[model samples]
Target: MRTIMVKVKPNASEAKIISENGNELVVAVAAPAENNKNPLMRVFEL
Candidate 1:
């Protein structure tokens, strides 16, 4: 199994992840916290 580290930003207008020079990742998701949705779903969308 492989793990990629990512920083998550919840409730954004869009869902996406940006690489930061291979050292870090920035993740944004459209799903709000009130919906019982997990931000990790953003990765599945990729």
Candidate 2:
């Protein structure tokens, strides 16, 4: 799994993590409050 240090800050609504497709930041999914520590891991689908 991989992690992305989003420029957006945490605890700021899930909408903060936008997707960059075609250089355009689009709304992806609504992730719940993830109270995780450093070195996060992300599992992508497709």
TM-score versus the correct structure, for each prediction:
0.32, 0.26
lDDT of 1 by residue, 1-46 (tens): 2334443455667766654444445555455667635545323212
Model 2 TM-score, 2 decimals: 0.26
- lDDT against the true structure, per candidate, is 0.49, 0.42
Off by more than 4 A, model 1: 1-10, 36-46
lDDT per residue for candidate 2 within 8-30, as digits (tens), equals: 23354554556555434433333
What RMSD value applies to candidate 1?
Answer: 5.3
Worst lDDT run of 10 residues, candidate 1, spans: 37-46
